[model samples]
Target: MTTKIRMTTPLVEMDGDEMTRIIWKMLKQTLIEPYVDLRTEYYDLGLEHRNETNDEVTVAAAHATRRLGVAVKCATVTPNAQRVEEYKLKEMWKSPNGTIRAILDGTVFRVPILVDCIEPFVRTWKKPITLARHAYGDIYRDVEMYIPGKGRAELVFTDGKGGETRLVVHDFEGSGVLLGMHNLDESIANFARACFRFALDMRQDLWFSTKDTISKKYDHRFKDIFAEIFESEYREKFEASRIEYFYTLIDDAVARAVRSEGGFIWACKNYDGDVMSDMVASAFGSLAMMSSVLVSPDGKYEYEAAHGTVTRHYYEHLKGNPTSTNPMATLFAWTGALRKRGELDGLADLAAFADRLERSSLRTIEEGVMTRDLGILSTHPSKKIVGSEEFLREIRLRLEKSGEAGRSCR
Candidate 1:
């Protein structure tokens, strides 16, 4: 008897740049292709290709993801001034992620790589705590002006039907900060829905935090909206799933997060997500190990490596030097997206394959077979550091051998 392999849905693949890009190709060749019969729609989204296509490639990729319901992406360059000069880019293009998020209107969830040997900065985090950031219309997109004269500062909100105004501040006596910004009810509603969806998907408790006490009317509105939505829509599902929705002050949430053991979904405002993600990344380990997923409110998804292009190491690799680049995050991008795709299509075998791959990667690390980043943290520091090719080859060998010997069977 022979086992049959099948794919219920296609996965959109956006290839990217630098060290992880190299890892991306290697991963598909080794781990994914060998196990599953994947129907992948490939788009070369490397910087050069992006420039050649005038960044239309990214837009198309996002559309494909929306249609297909799942996308696995490599970490691409969000080119800045330095990158513009280095790559001789025609224009300083926007981040591919930003472009995709705008199209999908999604929230980005970042979760760290938790290895037993690599101790987290926040010692209490035994499990990975996922952070879902509402990636729209807050500090990221704000209108501000400095008040030179002592007049007044008002946040005048106007609707199409009528206008209602609120004096955000009055008597600006001293030279201080003044800003006017707002979130649309539509956007906030989508964000709340995404958070609820993510928590339900992960079967984890959802935590929301805000400075609602201080920003009573503004931030409080967000709090109230989330609460209302949760109560009206998500309460029953959350309870049924044996998960909970928690709201708290930002400071208190931070304190609780540090003290408590991990394994919860933290729904954050834009600014908080940006800041806390870095903290979470650092606590977990190196940025190279973090996995990120952009999940739209409508259930469309794109998963990717969370770190930037390792330019420093890329230069060495360009010189034909053996670099110990970690491919774990990139690998997870494929697995995570595929797992979601499986769930979406009700393909249990495909989902199980992803689970197996994830376990294999983690087991490889736990067994002291890792790249330089993780090898450095080994209890026996004398462990040999492996190059990119060597490390991946070793991982492949281990995965294959484990399957053959049925090591995990017992």
Candidate 2:
């Protein structure tokens, strides 16, 4: 930037692990700190530190996000039994994302980072598609069990007023599987509002899908919630904007998405979002090029990459090889956080810097310079493929050029 950006509020910064972690520091050093006096409440969310703090640090970081109202996070590991053995942890810790989403009552939105040089895997896609997932509850928090042969499975709900209601989930004739999941009306309402508001902010049409025909009571509730919120609160605004809120069956949505030119907001429930977001990422580009954020109904934002820590690249790095790891999503995460902070705090310069950073990153790729992953996917005959650090350097140069444009416009 031509001049440093002044910020009124500090952002919650949750750092993470592996190759992305290495890229995180370079992103700030090369792109952010040079032009912005960034103020952040830093929490080391690296796997070892998480184990050391017994994951209290993760909880504290989530709380910090609520307090700060804007957060930028790196991709972190949610350990399993295998990871527990590898890292020597106290316990296989819960996903920091799950914890943060619960605490914030947020909706996760995934948007692909688009570039002209590379075509989407799906030939029909002509624009970007943003997927908003109701991340709070669903199968992620479900109660599941394998049915012993010839057993009855009933969902029991007690109102705490000495009244109980039971719904027969299954009356098994033989050995089978059973699962029960519950979502609160409050959370559903919050998710609806977040998705609708995000559609408004993004200026895109909103499409929500569920298997309500097959799941009248369970899945239908989500469809009902979105319609109720839209009709009650957002219907007028949506009409005024000349944008429509469309609902369809999940199967139909998939088929429509496959054939149609993509440019809209797709609202999905917990499990559908999990599956579709991955499909959407791969269909658009590498997961490393997708940007994700969690937005609370009240407008708190936490930005993160849609992908993992690039464990393979980290291993290669350990062997002293110059790994061509992609860092687009992580860079976008920082920019997203910065832009939210700027917008909320009335710091246009900071917001402009965020814009410039994004444009520069895109420009770098558009100019036929990119990391190997994207370079290989790109149609450019002579794309300059560079290693992770060198790729950041290329984007940094583009960002300086972006700064010049900002200076001239001012």
Candidate 3:
């Protein structure tokens, strides 16, 4: 029997909703607890509970993450009108992720988890591309209004003294909509530093994009900040690391990304990153194979699956049906949190366990045993499709065998 690894600090575990909540329990029981003497400061961010706490639980969880420095979150439900009615909520609660990102002021980094059996749809791609998304302030926090008729829209800023700056947004001939979105210089600088530091750490080229030609004031601010910070703060270190940083228009960046071989980091605004990450995930494979991490400026990290809660699979699970929902991203989320925790606490054995577990999972899929989604995308000749539970059990077997052999991937 293999002794469980001991943890010095507890991980902040945010439990989510629907099918992922089910898988969360299964993962802890099957693959984790049996091997590691796991410790977690747990928070239930499930939709029903969020509504019960009036979303205070989400705020509390974010604070706990800041206090603990590392968190692993399960995918939660972001309620729309339909979800509000389905879950019978008090009001349409805001996204827990949005609330957390706002409090943490973090940047999201998403990268694809590549396996040997699956080839990317993009023929030229030889490696994984990481997308760094500015996780605060865009249309997400915009204020909008419907014009009654023949009205004008203006953006106004007032100094506390007596000075005021006002600019006309639009003049309406007929009824139209007006929107105002804002971002902070502080947030933009943080985003730039995060990207630069990440690039230096990964030793990859950094590319940033904005539609500065059209939105001169707004988008140009982003470009200017990145350039100034790269020149002032990170240029010498980047030169020492032999990494490059460049800026281009978003459209041109997209075209370059599609044509070029993929081993670099692409930085984008909130909306563009939101859209392009999905496109890149699909072009490479499924969103289930993408790992997401939010890194705050102060070095706090939160790991989560890039995809949503498997709602359809949840319904199937309710009917006592075995579902083949992929758990790759969530598994990585756990490993990432564990690895970070181990590193911070100086626990080499714990860190080694995280590495070995990740290798075991990839080895499982590379050997042609996977869940339904990956099974469809995989071109392995001897494919063996399995349900979620069986797939995890297979991983458990590998974990146990690897543990017994005292194998170390690092």
Candidate 4:
């Protein structure tokens, strides 16, 4: 009997919706199940299932991640008004990413999967750039109102010690807008630590950006916290590792990012990260090839692809049309979660199998076998573009050819 890699801990697996959903199953059937004794605490985050469970399944999955230490998630649909009608959903569901991020108090980090054939548009780019996004409260959870006329907005704080503080945020002049936003020092501290720890793990420099020069208190707090944490806890290790952390104005950071070689982690505020990550994904080639992970301050991790559910492809697939959705990032999600689970559980063989799968996937792309998206962007001209399932099959063949099918990860 061929021995399979043993998994000592169950990874909390969150299944998503649509085309990527289809790819998720293929990933397990072809690449993972054949070699590993798979174990997972499965949560169906599919739109229908989320609705059927009143989204309690998502809550349970997040809790499971906290308990289990690792999770692998598929891309899910964040329903819109149209989707509510289409899926007969109970309500316009919130972003699964947002929901889980709030629960775990985590930061979302995005890193692209670089291949030789896939040349980043930026000529100077080489290594992968990771974005550590503070996905917590900021403008994401802000209260906003459209003012009809002149009005005063106040920031109020009641100490409950018989003293109250009130400051005028803005005095609106004819037909304007108002917003209230705040962040906790504790949350900022946690975000800093996660970014620092992640940068150290990747052995790369960490660059934190904010318009600290303008929004002095708000943005400066982020800068101050990162500086304080590094100086007090991580400076020694960072120096020993020859990696550095620097704070800069967001504009200056963007310019530097465009001109410089890519090998560091860019630490961003909630809104900035949301905007810039899309730019980074496109510049690197495609969102379909980017990997993302949510890392909590307490060390819980959830890995996922950095893209959305391919609704267009899913619709086409529903019509029985061939879909060539890129699966690199999704594949990485599984490998990342498995590797972390293996590390935490001392299952070296499981981790090694993940590593092998990753190499095989990359090798397939490098050899000019790719999906339609990559075939269009890849620098190589000698390419054989195939559908999603066919591409995965090609990867599976290469993985089997690696000659370590039954060997221990050790």
Please report, in order, the local distance difference test score of every candidate based on alpha carbons.
0.83, 0.88, 0.92, 0.90
lDDT by residue (tens digit), candidate 2, 277-341 = 88999899888889999988777899999899899999989999889999999999999999999
Alpha carbon RMSD to native, model 3 = 2.6
Q: Where does model 3 exceed 4 Å of error?
A: 146-150, 173-176, 403-410
Candidate order by lDDT, decreasing, is: 3, 4, 2, 1
Evaluate model 4: give its lDDT. Answer: 0.90
User: In angstroms, how far off is 97's CA in candidate 3?
Assistant: 1.1
321 Cα displacement, candidate 3 (Å): 2.5
Residue-level lDDT of model 3, residues 78-101, one tens digit each, is: 999999899999998888888898
Candidate number achieving the greatest lDDT relative to the actual structure: 3
Across 1-410, the per-residue lDDT of candidate 4 in tens digits comes to: 78988887799999999999999999899889988889999999999999998999888999999999899999999888999999999987778887788788889999988887778989888888899999788876677888899888888889979798999978888888888888889889999999999889999999999998899889999999989999999999999999999998999999999999999999999889988888898899999888889999888999999888899999999999998999999999999999998888888888888898898888888888899999998776578899999999999988988754331111
RMSD for each of the candidates: 4.1, 3.3, 2.6, 3.6
Q: Which stretches of candidate 2 lie over 4 Å from their true place?
A: 1-3, 144-153, 168-178, 403-410
Query: Which whole-number lDDT from 0 to 100 does residue 334 have in model 2?
Result: 96
| Candidate 4 regions with alpha-carbon error over 4 angstroms | 145-151, 170-178, 403-410
Q: Clashes in model 2: which pairs?
A: none
Ten-residue stretch with the least lDDT total in model 4:
401-410
Candidate 3, poorest ten consecutive residues by summed lDDT = 401-410
Count of residue pairs whose backbone atoms collide, per candidate: 0, 0, 0, 0
Instruction: Please provide, for model 1 over 192-252, each residue's C-alpha lDDT reduced to its tens digit, 9 standing for 90 to 100.
Output: 9989988998999999999998999778988989999999999999999999999999899
